[model samples]
Target: MQSFGTSARVGYDSSAFYDRKIYAEPEEVEDGSSEENAVPELNRLYAHSSSSMHELPDNSVHLMVTSPPYNVGKDYDEDMSVEEYRRFLTEVWEETYRVLVHGGRACINVANVGRRPYLPLSAFITADMIDVGFLMRGQIIWNKQASAGSSCAWGSWRSPSNPVLRDVHEYILVFSKGDFARQKPECEQKQATIGRDNFLEWTKSVWEFAAESA
Candidate 1:
C-alpha cells in the first residue's frame, strides 16, 4: 500500500502521495479482461482517516457511523485543547460530507465530558456537521442502565451547594448529506426492510441498553 500521509494531524495535505492500491488487486480472470477492469478487493486500511478519505471518490459512501475520541486523556487520544479538538472534528466532518452520497447518513455517537467546566461535545459536533452542509436529523439517546450507579461523586453530599450530575447516557446525532431520504435501488429496498416490532421499538427517542464491558 502507498503511504497516503505520514502525519496524523488533521488538515494535513496528502496530495503528494499517490496510487489507489490500498486494497488488494483483484485476481485475473480466465477471460482476456485486463486488471484495470477487475474489481478491487475490499480490504481495511489502517492509516490517518483524513488522508485515507482523500483516496475515495466523491459521493461514494452510503452510511458512516463513527465515535470520535473524547480527548479526556485516553491512551490513544492526543492532548488537545477544546478549540483544537473542535477544529479536528470539523476537518473530519468536512471530509465525511465530501465522501458521502447525496442522501447518505452520518451517525456520531458521543458523550459530553465532565471536566472542570462541562464540555458539550455532542452539541459542538452537531454544529460542526451542520456547518459542513449536512442536514440535521433526529438524535437518539442511548441510556446505559447498567452504569447508573457507577459514579460516586456527590458534590456537597445532600447539601444545597454545588452538585454534579452523573452521566450514564450518550447521544447518537444523525445527519444526512444533500437530502433526508437515501436513494436506493429496488433490490436494496427489499433487503433493507426492518421487522415491524424492531422498527416500532427503534423509532422511539430513548433506547435502554447496557454499556459495553471494557
Candidate 2:
C-alpha cells in the first residue's frame, strides 16, 4: 500500500489530472484558491482509499471524494468475482460510515464494466453502501465522448447476435450518513466560490468532461 497527499486543484480551469470544483474557505486546509500559500498538508493515503481510511478518527471527516480501483484487472486489485468485489466494498463502506461526521457526504466515482457478460458494478456498490447505512442522494453521469471505446473494442460490430455498445461514461454516486438535515459546523468557516456558469453546468446530472490520461 502507498500513501500520499490529498488536495485537488480548486477554482478556475486547469488541465490537472484531478477534477476542478469551487471549494469552501479553508479552516484546517490552506486556501488553495490563492497562489501565495504553499501546498497544504492533506490527509490522504495512497493505499486502497477505503481500506486506509480506517486510520482516521470517528466523525472526523466532513466529505470524501474518491475514485476507487474498478477491479477490472487494475494493477492493484486482485482477480475476484463480482460477489467478492461486493463483499470488499462492504468493508470499505462500513469504515467510511464510521469515520464520516453526521450528515457527511461521500462521493464515489465508478462505472459498469463489460468483458463478455456486462456487470453493473455501480448498482451493486450503491446497494451495498445503502445497506451499510448510507442514504442515497444523487448521481452525476460523466460523459466522456473523447474516451469512447474504439472499433476494436466492439465485440461483433454491426452483427446483432453479439453487439457491444461503447463504454463512454462513468457515474459519480453521492451518499450521506445520518440525518440529511443535520448542520455541518464547517459551513461557517468555508464559503462557496462557485460562479453562475459553473453552478448551472455542475447542477445538471449529465456532465461532459475530458478524462485524465494515464
Candidate 3:
C-alpha cells in the first residue's frame, strides 16, 4: 500500500480526483479526513497526514505489491520532470525497505513513461532501488496482448527515424528487502517449489494474465 502525508497536492475543483476541502482540517492524512478515521481503507479521505516514507518501523510488512500513480494525468500527482519523478519513487522504495520483513518481497508494476520514447523508466527505477539497498530480483512483463496504447498508431510507422512503438506491455519489478532465509522449516521446502523458484531458465518475462484496464 502507499502512504500519503500532508505534503501531497490536491486540486479543489476536481471531484473526479479530489474534494475542495481536503487537507483543510485536523486530519490523519493530507486528504482532510479526521484523525479519528485513520485506517487503511480510509486513507484517501483523511487529512493532516504525517506518514513518512523513510522512517517506518522495521519488519512490519510481509509482502507488498502496488501500482502507484504515475504522476501523469492524475490530479493528486503534480506534474514533474522524469528525473524528479524518479527521486520521489526512490523515497517510496526506501520506506518499503524499512517496513518489510527480512524475507519480504515488494513487487512494483510500472509502465514506461515518455514524451519521447527513448526514456526507459522501468529500468531506471529498478536500478535506483538496487542503489538504495533493495536487491533486484528480476522483471516480468505484463503483456496486454490485444490492448493498444495511445501512441500505437505513431509507432506503426516503420521508418527508422520515427518515434518508438506504443507500449502495449508493462513491467513488474520483483525486489527483496534483505537477505532471506525461511523462518520456519516447512517454508524452506516451499521455496524450492516451481512457483517460488525464480532461478529456472525456461521462465518467460512476458505474462498475459491481465487486461488493459489494469
Candidate 4:
C-alpha cells in the first residue's frame, strides 16, 4: 500500500474551471409579489462524525455524497485491520440507508490500494452497500490525471518482468434506496433541471479532471 504525506501545502488553482456561470437566471415574477421573489433559507449542517448519525431523521435525506477513509494507514483512519475496516464501513452504510428516502441516492468516492495484493476497495464497498439494502446504480470513473512520478513503487522499473500499473482514476459508486427514481413534487421538478453543458458532460461515465495539489 502507498502512504501519503501529512504536510499541508497550497492546492491547485481550479478557479478557471469553475468561473463560468452555466445556470440561467430565474424567471421574473409577473405579479411582483414579495413571496414570489423571496429566496428560501438554506439550512446546512457542517459537522464531522465517524459513526452513527443521531442528528438526522430516518428516511429524511434525499442524497448523500461521501469519501470515507481508505484504511491505508492514513492519519485519520487509526490503522484498522481489513475486517475492522469492513465492519466500520458496514455500520456507516447501514446508518446511511436508514436515513435515506425511498428513492434517495448515495454516492461514494473510493480508490483501490496496494500493488502486491491489489486491494479493490470500491468493489468491496459495493458489496457492502448491497448487503445494507442499497440498489446499485452503476459507477462513474473519475480520471484524476495521476502523475507517474508521484508513485515510488515501479516494480522492475523498465523491465517487463513485473511492471506496476499506475492508478490514474477513482470510482464514484452510486446507489439508490428502494427505488431507482427519486420522487419529487411538480414545483421541485423545475429546480432539478441540469444546465445544458453540464448535462452533456456529466452524463458520460468517464470524467477527466486534475487531482487536488497538496
For every model shown, the clashing-pair count is 0, 2, 8, 0
- What TM value does model 2 have? 0.72
Angstrom error of the Cα, residue 199, model 3: value is 13
Candidate 3, residues 1-214, lDDT tens digits: the string is 2233334664333343333466343321121211121123322432422225323345656677877668777767878787887887777787776667665688899887765445677888888877777766689988886665445555546667754566678889988765533253343455455554554543777776547453
- Please give the distance, in angstroms, between residue 174's alpha carbon in candidate 2 and its true position after superposition: 0.7
lDDT of 4 by residue, 24-130 (tens): 43222121111111112237564767368776766667788999889877677778877888998999899988777677789999999997799999999999998
Ranking by TM-score: 1, 4, 2, 3
C-alpha RMSD (angstroms) for model 2:
14.1
Query: How well is each residue in 108-210 modelled by candidate 2, as lDDT tens digits?
Result: 9998888678888889988898778787888999999877646646457678886667778999999887755446355365677999999999889999988
What is the C-alpha lDDT profile of model 1 across 112-210, one tens digit per residue? 997578899999998888777788788999999776665546564565576667788999999888776665755565664789999989998899988
Model 4 vs. true fold: TM: 0.74
lDDT per model, in order?
A: 0.75, 0.72, 0.63, 0.75
Task: List candidate 4 stretches off by more than 4 Å.
Answer: 1-50, 146-154, 191-193
> Roughly what TM-score does model 3 have, to 2 decimal places?
0.61
Candidate 4 lDDT for residue 113: 95
| Ranked candidates (lDDT, high to low) | 4, 1, 2, 3
Question: Cα RMSD for candidate 3?
Answer: 18.3
Query: Which window of ten consecutive residues has the lowest lDDT sum in model 3?
Result: 29-38
Q: TM-score for all predictions?
A: 0.75, 0.72, 0.61, 0.74
lDDT-superior candidate, 2 or 3: 2
